[model samples]
Target: MSFRKILVANRGEIATRVVRTARALGYRTVAVYSDADAQAPHARLADEAVCIGPPPAAQSYLSIPALLDAARRTGADAVHPGYGFLSERADFAAACAEAGLVFIGPPASAIEAMGDKAGAKRRMLAAGVPCAPGYLGSDDDSDERLLAEAERLGYPLLVKAVAGGGGRGMRLVHGTHELAGAIAGARREAESAFGDGRLMLERLIEHGRHIEIQVFADAHGHAVHLGERDCTAQRRRQKVIEEAPSPVVSAAMRERMGADAVAAALAVGYVGAGTVEFIVDAGLTHYFLEMNTRLQVEHPVTECITGFDLVEWQLRVAAGEPLSAWLPNGQADIRFSGHAIEARLYAEDPYDGFKPQTGRILHWQPAHATQAGRAPGAAASSVRIDDGIAEGGSVTPWYDAMVAKLIVHGRDRADAVRRLVAAIEDSPLLGVANNGRFLRDLLQHPDFAAARLTTTRLDEWAAAGAPLLQRPAPDDACWLAAAALAARGDVPTSAPAGLRPASVAWQTIALQCGSDTRRWRVRLAGDLVEFDGGPSVQLLGQEGHRWRLAIDGVTRELVALRHAGGWHLAHQGAGFVFTEPSAAPDQRRQADPGRAHAPVAGVVAQVLVKPGDAVSAGQPLVCVEAMKMEMWLNAQAGGTVRAVHIREREAVSAGALVVELDIDTVSTVI
Candidate 1:
């Protein structure tokens, strides 16, 4: 039953992850990609590669027939559907079985039973597992019926889509006034994302800790639990930081929870790696959430702590290898050691409501720099960066925003946090906005350090804003930028041969950053750049986005990247975007009096206001869709719409003008 070749039916870090282990075990690996990922790292790393379809997931990764076709064409004996896409799809699993291909996951019946949230809850109840009290009604349940169910369940419950993962189809309703709109919005988003609008109600656990147990099973009926991960640090219901061996889960509690998780797995007769999630309240009471029927995104931390490759276990179990062969004594003999933490590196702007960023990765120096030929002892202090994109790659708005997973292991929890912070600070990533600094700040936060975490921790910090936020770009950024500019031949060298060094013309350069403009006056004498005769500055050398600097008897490595005219600089955990002064129109300024521009790149989902229509301040003008989420563009001030430049279904780039408004005494038109 051993596989000769394994087709990784996925993309990004997870796909590359499977390929790495499969090839190591002497199995040839095949990778599938979309048009946007033709040059993706996973595609180029595999022994064989195939283009599935276009950028959109439906036309490619999520297509069952396409995946099966790829397996047949590549002569693959087995298919590994990495987490997401069709990993939990029962029909897809059954299709693989029918095609005489081994689906390296649970049986179709197990997936079918657990894929339905309500059905899984019913089974959990039957298996004596504690579950949150809620209404799991039938598909025919109408809006009125759902409203009634909410009334009975009480306010502040969750409106969750039964068939979808992520936060796509989730909404929080504190009262009945917002219940209807929440339901409608959740349904619409769920239908668009997962093709199923079915929903369920659950009691919202405020300030609760999200804990999940990793369970692995084999065809021989042997199952084992591999500790738990605390994923309470989240934003928008998606986990940002995950760590193995929850701080609150004592030995007694771990044993109880682990046993319950094992029961949940055995109840469904599940095989392969799965996660049983639960919500732990302040009083230490736990409630069953849902069971994921595939490998989890946070599985790396578990691997780092347990010293076992879960993906390898999946392959072995699928090849008819008994769990007893790997572990003679099963769950009882498994040992847990040390601590591990993983942070999700994403191409998103944390300052801007975590808006997804899409663009070219001008430079990418991963956390540990590279994954090849590293000495074994380096693993102790090194941060493991499981990344997917390269320096010249473009992160289009076609898939998940996650760029990599930064996992670090240490002798203990405090050591792990320290290493993680240092790793984030040393990471060289540029060209797109990210939350690396924010993650670093979170690791050092007093609450995080003291293990005082809950689901609402991120939300609380976001609401406080500025003072509580991560450190902003420091004043040293200017010094680094100036050094980079001087090194790039922006400074006059040797006084043009005619004039003496004293007669060299003084140069003044104006730089604009954000909303502020600053001017620097300097004169360059060969390698020395004199700033009003303050200090003789020398241009060392440039390495990627970083520059080695020697200023005022201090030598330091500064990160500075050149864009069009100015340089992007980062110091500590903060980043600053500096643009060189140019005569071109200022995009951030209100140059065109009444134009309303798009703040982010996305497709126009709806035009809320028509031309000549009056709009009030904060009124919805248009709705833009990007990365599977919809954002409403509201009017900044009350005005009358003069013209509409964008229509529904049209794609718009960031900063594109979408409307012209006539406000008070001014009216601008195109």
Candidate 2:
């Protein structure tokens, strides 16, 4: 049955992607969102939108009943799972089928078969597909039995949870001494995440490349492979960068892996778009890693290289159409064109252990860079950006922090990397912490350029003490000056005529970022402003409400507006509050000093301090679990804990104070 309307049961870029594809196929798309994503790009672009619940996934995206109700309300004939949440849940797929709606993915049986890693391995082995030698039997309680299995598998084994994917619930054991701890840790994590702590052992391939083959199938038993992707660049087993037509895979090896992947899909009687992941060792020995019975986030690179919409194909396949009918099977038909690379631009700080960042996307605009054949000889390279946010959108700390996916396509890998760098260098994202600079650095690195990488490369790079490329000194000074001038509403139309007397002019500017404050004094001389104890700045020009300032060698523009008792300075994609010196007394008294509050609403997994415990600045005081992700709350200042108001596993609201520290003691430490 052809679907006339589809409901995307997801959020962020993936939901946006499903809507775009569905629209192109002449199908109306319905988007379901939470309160946090009311203004998201997906909601704005969908033909119809409905608010399912609040910001939390449990109350919204992961709420099966809410999604089903939305689909029914919108008259959606099909529901696209979009990779995460209930994407691989057999019950969700079965429910959709029972509700007379297409799931737009693999069958319920296929999802169930691949959902259990151990079961999939057993199936793969029986089907003659290359499988990693490991323990998958029902008997797993005996320590001696596990030890014997580990010895047979050799040292450096991976203990993986049967019901886990993504890098969660897995532990690596290098020796027998660490085997039990690794197993226990993996079991604990698995139980906490999937509610099933069942684990299996496998021989670890120390320098293996993560390769995955895309497979498409129809209900009529016809299936074909759409080449391969290299997702070796990762951190904690989560992919960071992905590319199509892996640089490491030879044409012959590609054919072998592709055929094996197709075979694996057929073994499960799979249908629609799916991925068969594998780990290829240094010696080119490939082992099956489980299959993902849904669309992948990195599907864009494959589409770019193949010039085929996988989503469109998925829709057609779901309608019982065969693959060969769309594109005839021939040498020219199966060829991949150009190279495409995608970088997941997340709101995260790589310098701080890849901590997720959350705040408002005050300003956001893609770089105008253009490649040779991609966009002619444009001033800069043009990047294809898939994002779920717009300017002035709030990135709540409720979900994943990925702001966008920046993709670049070129005639070759080298060209793609160069274009990607140019695009990142030109992007205008401020206020929130982003890894654009780090992505650029990775693309230009010797190992990445040479394609000699593994999943652990990112962690290794971080351990090597690589410093992030800081914004040029000139640029920093320019932005600071622009912010100062913009705060005063004294934007000049042109460069200042000359210097003025410093004795008669004293401009006080107070800038507030988050809870931190900075005070500055500026002595104006004609159009030039000399900041006391800081760099000298010259007003260049003004355009509309923005003021251009030149300081130290770089030029920056800022927008100014008066709000409350402070001047709001908006620049480089961020918003800052600048207040006059005279208003400091009232502002200080009004500032909320309610201790450090929870950044997000989640269950307090652990409380690290007691009422009388002494803690140092930057020490972690609490750990919160939200959406299956763990985040630690750190102390901003050293002090004795005057009060402990929360307990382990307690549910807390965002901005709720969990601990109260003695301000007097903290001040003394400072």
Best by lDDT: 1
Question: lDDT per residue, candidate 1, 444-557, as tens digits?
Answer: 988888888888778777777844464454474465346436433543333354442343567865666675666667776655566664554555665656666666546677
Q: Which candidate number has the best TM-score?
A: 1
**lDDT by residue for model 2 (31-66), tens:** 999997888988988999999998767688888899
lDDT of 1 at 557: 77
Q: Please give the TM-score that candidate 2 achieves against the real structure.
A: 0.80
TM-score of each: 0.90, 0.80
Task: State each model's CA lDDT, in order.
Answer: 0.81, 0.76
The CA-based lDDT of model 2 is what? 0.76
The C-alpha stretches of model 1 lying farther than 4 A from their native spots are 367-382, 477-484, 487-505, 533-536, 582-598, 603-622, 635-652, 656-670
Tell me how far the alpha carbon of residue 66 in candidate 1 is from the true structure, in angstroms, after superposition. 1.7
